[model samples]
Target chain A: MADVAYLPGLPRMLPALLPADDNSSPWRFPQYFADHFSEVMGWLWAHTWLSVVPVIAGLIIALPIGWLASRHKWAYPPMMTVSGLLYTIPSIALFVLVPPLLGLDPLSPLQVPIALTVYSVALLVRVVADGLGSVSEETLQAATAIGYTPVGRFFTVELPIAVPVITAGLRVAVVANVSIVAVAGTIGMVNLGLLFDQGFKLSTDTPYYPPIVLGLLLCVLLALVLDLLVILLGRMLTPWRKAVRS
Target chain B: MIGNVLRWLNDPDNWNGTQFTTGIWAQLQTHLLYSVIAVLAALVIGLPLGLAIGHTGRATSLISGLNAVRALPTVGVLVLLVVIIAPHFHGRTSKGYIIPTLIVLILLAVPPILSNTYAGVQNVDPAVRDAAYGMGMTGPQVLWRVELPNSLPLIFSGLRSATLQVIATATIAAYVTLGGLGRFIYDGLAQQDYPQMISGGVLVAALALIADLVLALVQRYTVSRGLTKRFSKSTVGGAVAADLEEAGVEHT
Candidate 1:
């Protein structure tokens, strides 16, 4: 396997100090970082978008379906069942199966994001339905009595109230997607997961730590940031929550 | 594509082999073996800690920390462990692969179980705990007799989530040369064999569904009848959905 440090078109830093191609020298974080900084940033960039896009796409798609499930008593059971079953499918399986179903190349970069969207939808559907369902009957009547149209009521009243729950679901989806995207790297998808793949491949005779450690750090960091972002977004969307708390 | 996957699955050659790790049956066995072992080990560790936390209401910070651990990518951990630990064995033992894989699987499986158990115990109605204390039950007695029973649904929810995660991760274990259904997916990718890859996907999906179904049934049987009475206002499906919803909300 080729070392990421040797990848073309990136201006090298600390080339003289770069670890041997055979990995003779033990892992050094500074040397590795200097040698492959651009490459690492590229992986992180890909990782961020690959993970975040699916949750956004899934949330967009799930809202109407979840609203229907909450509104129609009969729709809730089947909707939950389908999503639950979908959620049960191993993510790797979904990644591989999705490409064929969609007539895309088996190794398409799109495979993972699409597969994750399935999961986000699977997860958020239940969250959305339950969040919307949490609105009390009296609250709905109040909205109606105030002459808000159903659409207007959903947008102004029910949706705002549902923000915390929906954001909670988004947090889970985002964090889980961050990890699952790395798993796709095992099958050759590009992302922070590729660093894991590279590190593993480099470890035939001796263990390599730099790439794996960097990947782990960046992944955990990404997940935490995304999680905090979702929480902050949740807080921003529900100002009344803080107003009541204060 | 479905036909191709079906044809690949229907082939007897894929299902039979003379040695372990040689066929679909062997891979299935290996996958389940790893998953079940990881879940059980997590249960041993997580259940106790969760019980103590839930019972004493101390060290709640540990639960939050464990929830953050959930965000660690499983494949990265598995590969890192393999890379870091495999060399220590000097190529003389398979423990290099097996140890790291199990560690990752167990690590991945523990959070949900621990948190759910804690939540289940904590969520036990205070009124009921008071009644148990009023009846002269000791703390341990109350935990065993009252909180544990009420906490069954959430505990099982955690168990199911962990099991599903372990099974899925065990498939990724094939990337590290551990034998399982993941072999088909990885090998298929290496060889560009889509049917075989899809077959692996189908088999894993089937395995996970069956495992979840079995766990659901076990939960249905194990939960006390009185608890069912409490949820009787909703249909069984609604009850399960409600439980699932709560599990997701609380665990996250």
Candidate 2:
């Protein structure tokens, strides 16, 4: 809920603050879409990157922590408590808090992704730990009995079985990231959220339909595409599941 | 910094106002009012739908479709709805903001409640369900007496998550010129008042934690003792993890 004061180092990209009457219409669907197609695409691309990079980064960071929590009985409660607490912090608060904690400029684009990555880490750590825990003990014993080293067994045996659950976690994280990234736009990051901000300010006197509708459509489309990509990737990685199914 | 925030909070001027109608208490009330109404709205809509879906084994695709709504950005949705709906209430600006804010809050709260309730009922042991039916309980009776009780833990978990989410998000309502504890953070940010902003953040977090703790206790006392022992080993984190898995299933 922090104020939206303009900062010097940030780009002078106040789309919402543009004079509302400059365009002189409440709706400009055809003309606006035609003129901003490439620009919209660019925002979509940035939005995709902003949402996905955090999930990837978070996964990398969470893997070891998740493994630790799953492997050690004593670690599970403490690990879950810490990560759960981390998840409860409000997104807006976290966005503002991160600047001071990380020594970044308040309006830096990096803050959005960093805060999202923290969220993804918090959400995924428990998922990863739970997914790993879901692997059957007998399967693990079989791997161990086959003279596989602990590391080898984990890589070859445990992780493979854990893929389905981990993929589910990834799906949730990716979708959540998509939503959180839009919040960044509210904070002045250059993404599809700019359209929302513009639409909001533009409609100060009269409702502006095009930008708001377009922003919602594009945001949903991007989310669906990313979600489908994760599902497809999951399917590709787990061919045995299909074999078992058919 | 903490002392400064504490001092600011304790300031007589900050606390002084008309009796029972101003200061931090009023903002807390507004925040709680928004969150409670939204959660209740979500419950009214989601609980029945989830129960129906779980009981009948139909309309599951509806749940999956609704799950996608979770990915819709809350802020964007709020702004979009405001722009679309605000003009209708041309004379009353505050009502315009409040209506869209409540709509968005309800939208955000519905999914977890819907999904968890459905999953909880569906996941109930089938043998128990069959036994209840054999004992001459009607469908509604079984759902009310048997399934609902069993699903209490998950339903409570969903409500807890939904309440926390709504409370956190109600802060954004302040961005649209509505009043809540978020006023402090936003106003402080504008004035570059770090202590006030940080204090707002702390207060909101404290509220969320307290709300969660209270719900956990409610979950403890409301469910039967046997059910508690059955799930005693499962912590809040575990319940949340399970809920996330249900969410994934609903999406898929």
TM-score of each: 0.89, 0.85
What total of clashing residue pairs does each candidate reach?
0, 0
Number of clashing pairs, model 2?
0
Model 1 off-target regions past 4 Å?
A: A1-27, B18-21, B230-252
Docking class of 1: acceptable
Candidate 2 per-residue lDDT, tens place, A1-246, comes to 133444421233234334454453334555676778999889889999998999999999998999999999899999998888778888777877676577766556788889899999999899889989988889889989989999998888888888888889998888888777777676568888888888788778866767776787778888889889999998998899999999
True contacts kept of 2: 0.48
Q: Which residue pairs come into collision in candidate 1?
A: none
Give residue B162's error in model 2 in angstroms. Answer: 1.4
| Candidate achieving the largest TM-score | 1
- Can you tell me which runs of candidate 2 are displaced by over 4 Å? A1-30, A37-39, A103-107, B1-12, B15-22, B230-252
True contacts kept of each: 0.88, 0.48
- Candidate 2 at A29: error in angstroms? 4.2
